[model samples]
Target: MTWNYAYSQDLWPAMISVASTIFLGFYSWNRRNVPGAKAFAIGCLFAMLWAIGTSLEIAAMDFSTKIYWMKFHALWQIPTVTALSCFFIEYAGLGRFLTRRNLVLLSIPALLVFSLMVTNNYHQLIWTSFELEEYVVAKYGIGTWVSIGYANLLGLVNLFALLRLAIRSSRSRWPVAIMLFGQISGRFMYVIDSLYNHIFSPGESVLVVIGLSCSLYAFALFHFRVLDPILLARTIVIEQMSDGMLVLDMQGHIVDINPAATEIFNRPASSLCGRAIVEMMPSDSGIEVQPGKIELTKFEINLGLGDAARYYSLGLTHLLDKSGEALGYLLLLHNTTEQRRSHELLLDKQRVVATLQERERLARELHDSIGQVLGYISMQAQTAQNWAVAGNTGKTVPILSRLSEVAQEAHADVRESIFSLRAGMESEWSFLHALRKYLDHYHTSFDIDTELLLPEELSEDILNPDVGIQVMRVIQEALTNARKHGGAHKVKVVFVEEDGYVIISISDDGIGFNQADLILEVGKHFGLTFMRERMTQIGGSVIIESQPGSGTTVVLDVPIGT
Candidate 1:
């Protein structure tokens, strides 16, 4: 082919189209990793090629050179339309249709048209005849009409995708509207150029007008951030998060929910949206979801029953607009079932440890007190039997009386030990109430009168449960000593709070022993030792006061908040 080039008025518009398209092509290419950007870049590049070929065809003076450039321009037209169609489909969030197989199928028509246009010399199928007039004119053939129809069909699909997107997404409407206008304007210019060439042709290539219309795409891209990945990233994060998320309106109705939220409620998003949140919650959830009344930041709720039970920590957050006006609420349900199970297991282990410790203490008490007393009684009985067999009644009588007294003391100790073993705090009873109940039971069992004097201001909340148990044990020991050792008829237990300490006094109207003699025998008295040890374990102290003629008093000074 021979080339003869001459500049025409149409060269200016074609050159402008080339520059604009090349700029958009490079811009789109830089954002190729974003959804739909690669296809948009391909479309821009082909549009640039069409502009370059049309410029060359318009400037050529001979029919043959003009025909060659027209064929080149025609070759890029189908690829441009196909690429833009794919971009629109992807932009509308219909990327599932753009599979590799579908892309290959879409390209087949472009390839067939390209081959026919390239082989037009042998078939004369693309253009039947060419004339060199004021402008180079060509008669269209069956192949040319077929390519036009296919391009038009692709354009219609692209328009439909954009229109649907504009209708569904309010935020995306502006950009989609711009793109739709560009596409429709390009198609309209093409139709006007083809049908009214003699009367309305402005001596400019139709490619120039189409390329200018596509510049609206570049404007939308720059102004609206059409290729930004922020929206896509947000959607992915929300859908894939492990924590269930719900977006609710000011009326406490579900506006939207993530996939995790759907799974948590065992309902679809379509079924959940527009329904009241309280209706969706479990009946026993105890969640107050009355819009402005939902002040709870974190709450635990149980769903299901038995082995299928799940625990969740629901967190509420207020959604506000820029003006600080409340828009809605966001509910985040985090699964805490595993954490709850672990806590229960720990409590079980603690209970086991406490039970073991209690058993060890009981064994020690038996060994230190009852066991030793029983052994002494056994030795005395043997001695008395020996004396009686030898006919020595004088020594045997005194020994038998001592044995009777020791046996009675041992019996009282056995009863006290059994009472201590059976004592436990019930969940519903307060410490003071339980203590009074125990005193009533003690009076009935021991046949001794007991009086409890408690301070009116003293509350059960001040003492720890573990410390309360030890205090009760110490009180029991004091009452037992009053009856068995002091021979007391009546006892009074008094409680007083002073200087951040609770002072409990257990006084008995018994024949008291000398304080000096009691000090000397302190190591032999297991009850006193046990009481002191128990009080010390709970950050408290035990004090005993007595005189030869006065009553005995056991004083407990327990520090508050221990």
Candidate 2:
């Protein structure tokens, strides 16, 4: 392997190509973080290698030195083509194809071509023969044709990718077009040099084409910012949004729909477009789309029947042109199916808790009232039996009489408990309405006159369901005690608002008791204890005003917003 050097006119263009490619390689390497930039840098490196080898081959005087350099330059062409193909593939947003397995597959042909070029001296598979005139010329062999075909295959793929990108992107069209022109011109020059070697020598052609291509690449990279990320347009935003979007013409016909809308409707865009907006809605959706009738509207809609139904919050607004003229309507549908299901589940859990609470309250009432009464009756019967057996008939008769009275009171308590358990507010019934109904029933059942007084500005919406139920139970207990224990003939219930509080006063025309006796009486009478506990649960308080001779009054102090 003897080496020799001589001056040649081709050296200038080859050196220029080397410098230009080296600059492009480093420039692209600086932006390697950008998509496709690393691959482009690698391609520039291979192009630089080809330029260096071509320059050395042009300066070599001996045929043997020239042939060796030619082989080196030819070997680099395979890798350069492969690297550029990878760049275009990534730039076209198809980088998924560049998996490790696919990269290995892509490199197989380059490795095979390299092996054939290296062993060409033994088999002459790359260049059958070489002739040295002013430039080294070679006759192509089967291996050379194979390498050419493989390179052209990759070149076509790169061209298709760039062309697709140019067509699809309006903002990057100019940059893509410039790169496409560079690729086409480089390939065209190679083809011309291959066909007409007398007019265009291989070394000069390769250097000139590499320099031209690198200049075009630099222009696209610096002047047009080709490697920078593309800004999202309104259409791109609409297309990629999670919420479904529909654009309808002024006549309420669908003009365009995004992929999300297509998925929501479970139909293709072609079918959805040119159709009336109402035609796609479920029959019971309750959505009315009247064009120009309203400036903006919103409502919830159910799209399917039974368990498969999906809920969406649909918003409609007029799409206006720059001149303020109504162009069409923009319908935005946000899926709320999960939220609706969550709300229903929450209500179910609440109902379970309410039912459990009601059962516990009933259990407490039975234990405090009926359980104590039954125990007292059992003890009184045993005492009466002992008195009768000892021949003390006078004491036994009074004990038996007292037992009968206790039995009657227990029966009345049972009835009252049943009534309280059965009393409930209907969905449409207000707290005041339920209270009035209970009072009417009490008057008819007990023959006790009842009167209700309410403030004029009282609102039914003031009390929530839980507060209303607790208040009603407390009032019922007070009215029952006024009749049974106090022996009241008439009751007056008054509702008055004072200082952000609703004070309920129940006055009874009944025998009064000493205020000092309430502590001892509360232990014996669970009704009074239960009333205080109920009010306390709802952030309220109960006060009893009474004397030995005057009528009694029960006052409840309840906060307005509780």
Listing every candidate in turn, what is its Cα RMSD in Å to the true structure after a full C-alpha superposition?
A: 7.2, 7.9
* Residue lDDT tens for model 2, 1-562: 6798988887888888999989888987887877788999999999999999989998888889998898898888889989989988987767888999999999999999999899888998888998888788888888877787788888899888887765544445777888888888887787677656535665567755788888887898888876654532353577589899888887778877877999999887778888988789766555565645433333878788799998899888888889999888888899999999999999799779878877887788778778888999999999999999999999999999999999998887787667765676376746787888889988987889999998789997667777888899989999988887789899999999989889999999999889889776657767788788889888899999998768789999988777
TM-score of each: 0.65, 0.59
Q: What is the C-alpha lDDT profile of model 1 across 158-269, one tens digit per residue?
A: 8888887665444577899888888888877776666564232222554435565667887788888888678657766876899999888878888888879889989877
Please name the candidate that would achieve the greatest lDDT relative to the true structure: 2
Error of 2 at 366 (Å): 2.9
RMSD (CA, Å), candidate 2 to true, equals 7.9
